[model samples]
Target: MKKTSDLEEQLKEITQQRNLLLKALDVLEEGIHVVDSSGRTIIYTKGCEKIEQSKSDYILGKHISEAYELDDETSVQLRVLKSGIAVKNHHTSYITSQGKRADIITNTYPIFENGKIIAAVSVNRDITKLGELTEKIIELQKNLYSGEQKRRKHANGTIFEFDDIIGESDSIKQTIKIAKKFARSLSPVIIQGETGTGKELFAQSIHNYSSRANGPFVAVNCAAIPESLLEGILFGTSKGAFTGAEDKSGLFEEATEGTLFLDEINSMSMLLQTKMLRVLQNKTVRRVGGNKEIPVNPRIISATNVDPMESIAKNQLRNDLYYRLAVATLVIPPLRNRLDDIPILARYFIEKNSKIMGKNIKYISDEVFEIFNKYNWPGNVRELEHVIEHAINMADSTDTKLSVQHLPPHLREKFTHKHHFYKDYKVNNLQQTLLDIEKDIITQELINNDYNITKTAKSLGISRQHLQYRLKKLNIKKQK
Candidate 1:
């Protein structure tokens, strides 16, 4: 009788332990399910009920196949039971008996009893929401970067406006006045300027000042894209047109009721020019492989570094296209032509760069301005901005003023050889002429060798120490 009572007590403890483990499994976020070797479900937690959208009462004692309507090949638990091998992070999609769809990632492991398959356990994670979120993120990225070769040239954003254009010169003012006037008109405007003369800046300013300011401002560089893809880029492609091609909107369609700025328009192919002329004439565009004509009403703003007339003469730009695009032409003068604005531009850039670089640059030396005015800036305003940024970075932390010492080695060399000797010679007597000439030659050699003391000395057929002495005597500081 005592043995029977002890056995009953032991069985009660085992059942309580099993119930505690089942309760623990039920609290987990991941679905926990166990099936016997015969494929009958032995355990089904509340998490499984939530994941499958079914009650445990229906699945706990039934065959997994009958309850979930899944086969041995589809059910991860049954696969593990049959194979005696664990399956880790297997993805599956299924429709539940209640008609609810679910995407799940599951891990299934077989239970071993003395090397014999007894049961299988599956841990399921419902990732339907995560999958939906991932899909949404991918779609947003596609919308931002979708095009042939993933070209984002016509991405919808503007970085500059009329107020951002920094120039007080009369020529720049006149250009701005014409650009403002062109903004009010829907006619296509052509901007001609040297590279880096802020052609795109004017395009953005016009877009911001126009009636289409609320819409997207798309910009594309004709020279940046391949010639073969220009047509499809300007006019969209339809599905079934080619392998891997989908129904895609071109820049013209994408910029509907907005502004489309085509930069370096002179680089467009002749065939594209003819197509563009037709679109400008009819204000309609047909896709590359489709016959349907789409009426696009976007404001056109084209820019070129080359002269439009010269481009036409060289067969680079179509005469008819030029005439249509140049209805309100705005020519931006180069930086050298507007020397009067250099001081203001320099001060503005200094302040701007100071804030960006966390510096306290208060002044630019007169010598620096003299060199800036003398150098012919082939790269224009953009080059000037870069030069200022370079100077700010080269300036000493303790120095509040930008000086010739902070200038780039090339500019410093040019300035030292060109102006410093002549100015000093004129002020001093004729006795210093020979010394000044020698100093100029030594300085030029030092610069040519990138301020290498040994190389400059060797090129001058002197010792490194002697060159150092000459540099100090000439009051020229070698950058450390």
Candidate 2:
């Protein structure tokens, strides 16, 4: 009798705790759904009811397939239950029995009991309204981008040509040579490089050089838009598809007979990448919420700020999509790797910004060149341009050249700490001269070997360890 009473007490406590947790979940803005192993809906919170436009009583105790318009393969909850895996930030859309559409990003997890999968839980966040808003914003941006074409004095939407790519490095020249070859064939091209390495510049150049140069050149940055809306934006949306969807043409259609440049393709969701691959393969695109397959003949050019193989290894990029898009690959070397171009680029930026700022900045000082050679340009040419623009902005009326004092404070401080006080040059200091010579020799060797430390060390007849130590002591770093 005593044991029975204790058992009853424990049951009561567990039920109470479960009720409390359910109540807490109900108060959240995101919907909470729980299902048994058999796919029956065991628990549905108030948030779930609100988002789905259905009452919890109607869903609870019903199999998920009957409760909602989802099957075993389509249902994330069921998928998690079967695989005992978590599906995180996965976007899906379905219609409620109430005739309302719910677009949501779901994070579904398998619930384990005693090390066995017993149930599944899902947290769904409504992105329907956000998707609508993004659509409106995208429409506005499309108009804005279209209007800029006239201002740029270019047909379609391209402003830069091959000549605009201001780099003399062999790597850049070779990349351009390959891009020009790709432009002749109407096949897809993939440009891979670090951020700010002008991957888009190469993409635009390829488009301008292609036969489709006369047609529209549509460009989209995959990372800029939400994954939920990106599909509708890339593929057209049909009117009556959602609450406020309209009959709109997607970028693929917009760039028909031209080029579609997908920047940061690695940022696209795998599901979207699959859709893109299908469209590329078929040369046709279907509108979201529509059943029509629109034929598109746009030359595809995709750019990624990540290595294709690395992104594929990490599962950030779809392997099939990478292979499909990389028919022609162009790799633009980072600014640090092409150190020889720095002087020419600096001079170009100086002249350009000097004209804009109404200054006569004629030269970059020798000391400034030395500092440039030492610093790793992580942000690449864009960073160099911005640095030059900033120096030009800060230049005095009497100054004829950009000097150490005129450099951005961060660069100025780094140079001062690493090298010497340019304000007080010590020409007779033999130790300082020797240090300068050693630093110059190392810098030259690094450049000669394409910044390969091992090769540089071997050429200098020093151990790799010794070279690394010397590099660290000298505060020399490769671009990240």
Top candidate (lDDT): 2
Q: Model 1, 1-480: lDDT tens per residue?
A: 999999999999999999999999999999998898899889989988898788888777788778765787667788788889898866566767576776777888999999899999989988778756554643453354444424523334665688888889998898899899999978899999999899988998899888988888877788865554557678988764432345788889988999999999999999889998898788898886688999998899999998899999999998988998988999999999998888889899999899889889988876678888999999999888888999899876766877766778788777665444444456365658777877778866665455657767987899988888888888876445
Q: What are the models' TM-scores?
A: 0.58, 0.65
Tens-place lDDT digits, model 2, residues 149-225: 54774766667899998878898788788889988999888998998999878888888888888998888888978
Best by TM-score: 2
Error of 1 at 338 (Å): 1.0
Error of 2 at 44 (Å): 12
lDDT for each of the candidates?
Answer: 0.81, 0.84
TM-score result, candidate 2: 0.65
Separately for all candidates shown, the number of backbone clashes (residues 3 or more apart, or on different chains) is 0, 0
